[model samples]
Target: MRAVYILPALFVAGVVALSSVYIVDERKQALVLQFGQVKQVVEEPGLGFKLPFIQEVVSYEDRILGLPTQPIEVTPADDRRLVVDAFARWRITDLVKFRQAVGAGGEEVARQRLDRIINAAIREIMGGVPSTAVLSEDRTALMNRIRDIARRESGSLGVEVIDVRLTRTDLPEQNLEATFARMRAERQREAADEIARGNEAAQRVRAAADREQVEVTSEARKNAEIVRGEADAQRNAIYAEAFGRDPEFFAFTRSLTSYERAMQSGNSSIVLSPNSEFFDYMNGVTAPVAPEVPAAGQ
Candidate 1:
């Protein structure tokens, strides 16, 4: 009868011990709750204890967590509507406040509240800026602003927002075609203007080259004519000098030249008189003989 009682007591103690002991994972935090109220908070990972059969433990992720927001439409200052998809990094900072705020709903409830806060901040900040700013490098600043807003709002939920990011920002599908068409038209108009300007410049250059060519050709012709005229005058002067030095010899040479020109044709029909001056040199009748002079000794 004693051994039987001892065995029953040991079983009861074992059951109580198992109920009081809990293991906390390194990546998680825990809360000790008694009668639906938070009794103790356990942030560090280790073995923890609780009152048997009355208290229980609730675990929450201690590491950074992610919350991906659904794609939402936002109208910017330019009135261009865009579809924005974003996500946030957050972590539970105060488990006591977290449990108090969300009650028995746990992290899921906190996440739902966080989602609302983030979406509201995104709309408020993005609506004030133009779509260009949202798509530009300034987007980082906008995200920071969003994170700050979310951080402030989420403080009540006992969570700290580490960062917020816009994963994708784009025009609505319905507006994509219209925007692309407008951009293409603008680019084409610019290209046409560039082409027209290039053509005008090329024409100007061609005109300059043609004018230069004409001027050069005209000047070269003028110089050539001047040289030809000077050559003709020099030849006339030489002829006159030769004639003045010996009239008879010049006449004889002129007669020989005339005869050669008249008979230069292989087929020659001379219809001139035998005494014609052109034939004087060939006839040898007009030849002049010089008178003999006495020697100096005589």
Candidate 2:
């Protein structure tokens, strides 16, 4: 009978002990609440104590978190509308403040609210900058401005914004076709200019080549004339020298040469007179002999 009573007493003690203790993981912090009022705050990891059956613990994450907002359309200072999508890295810094502000709504609700703050900040900053600035090197400065603003504005929600970034920015669907058409036209104009420049250069080269050809041909003709004149003068000089050596012999040889050329073919026709000077040698009529001259003594 005493053994049975001892078992019942031990079981009662076990229930009481289980309700008094709670385990907090390394990744979490806890708040002990009683009767809907805050009774204790547990930040450290491992086992913790709470009133049995009457107190409850609410756990909150103590690590960095992410909040991604949906893509939204924004107009820039240049009046260009763009579709923008962004995300933010954040974490709950003040547990007491966080719980007081939005603990009941939990992490999901907090994220929703954060999305609004980030979107509003993005629009405000992006709207003041030109589209070119957002797309150029100045984009870095614009993003920094946005992050600073989001961080400052998120402080009221007991959250710290670590970084803010835009993932994508592009023209709206309705504008894509028009933009592409304009780009094609610009490219075609550039191509036409390049072709015109190339043609001009080619014309200059062709004109130079034609001029050089004309100069070369004229110089060749001039050189040919000079060579022919030299040859004619040389032939005349040789004839004059031969005649001075022996005039009669020279005339006889010339007649013989002309006769040989005229009689080359048996059926060849000749219209010259038989006694013509050309046939003097062939007719056996030799050149006149020089009259003998007497010595001075005779």
Candidate 3:
């Protein structure tokens, strides 16, 4: 009978021992709570003890955690609306505070609260800047700013925000077509302005070229007329000089020239008298002699 009692006592003692002890995993921290109050926090990975049935151990991830936020629309300083998607890296820093802040709710409650804090920080920071800043490389600074704000706010919840990143920032789908159309119209207007300016410049150049051509042609014609007048004057002077040297010979030569021209046509329809001066050379008449040319010594 004593052996049976001893065996039952031993079984109860074993059950109590098993229930009082817990293993803390390397990647997680634990919190011991009794009657809805935090009694102890186990930060390191090892064996821990608590009351057999009155205390419960809650384990939370000690490693870095990830929280992806939902896409939210934000209006920047320029009043341009954009859809933003972001994520955060965080970890529980104070297990006691975490348990106290999210009593009976645990990591799930903490995550929800953290998500709100991050979203608020994103909106607040992004709303103050222009859309260009949000889209540019300066976005890294913006993310750092968001992380600081989130860290400050989430400190109350016992979580440290390691980093915050904006994965995607874009115009809303409804605005995409309108934005594209506006951009196209603006570019077309610029192109048209450029074309009009080019045409105006071309017209100016053509006008200048035409004016130059007219001026050059007029100057060339003036020079040609002057040259022709000079040549005519020289020829008349030479004819006068020959006439002065020998008037009779010159008259005979003129007569001969006139006769050849008057009878050049084979038809020969000239009704000139036989004694006409035009036929003086052709009639073999003796003409006045020309004065002899003086010798070089004379």
Root-mean-square deviation per candidate: 8.6, 8.3, 8.2
**lDDT (tens digit, per residue) of candidate 3 on 1-298:** 8998999999999999999999999999888889878888888999999999999998899999999998999999999999998999999998878877987787889889998999999999999999999989667889999999999999998889999999989999999999999999999999999999999999999999999999999999999999999999999898789889987878777665555565564544557577865554567765563223222222
Residue-wise lDDT of candidate 1 within 1-298, one digit each (tens)?
A: 8999999999999999999999999999998889988889888899999999999999999999999988899999999999998999999998888888998888889888999999999999999999999988667789999999999999999999999999989999999999999999999999999999999999999999999999999999999999999999999899789879986787777665555565565554557677755555667766542222222222
Model 2: per-residue lDDT, tens digit, 1-298?
Answer: 9999999899999999999999999999888989867888888999998989899888888888988898899999999999987889988887777777786886787798889888888899999989887767547777778889888887878789888888888999999989999999999999999999999999999999999999999999999999999999998898779888988887766665655565565555657677765555667777643222222223
**How displaced is residue 254 in candidate 2, in Å?**
5.5
Among the numbered candidates, top TM-score falls to 2
Off by over 4 Å in 1: 1-15, 100-105, 248-298
lDDT (CA) per prediction? 0.87, 0.83, 0.87
Please give the RMSD of candidate 3 to the true structure. Answer: 8.2
Best lDDT among the predictions, by candidate number: 1
Cα TM-score per model: 0.77, 0.81, 0.66
How much is 193 displaced in model 2, in angstroms?
1.1
Local lDDT at 60 for model 1: 94
Q: What is the Å distance of residue 31 in model 1 from its true position?
A: 1.1
lDDT of 1 at 38: 81
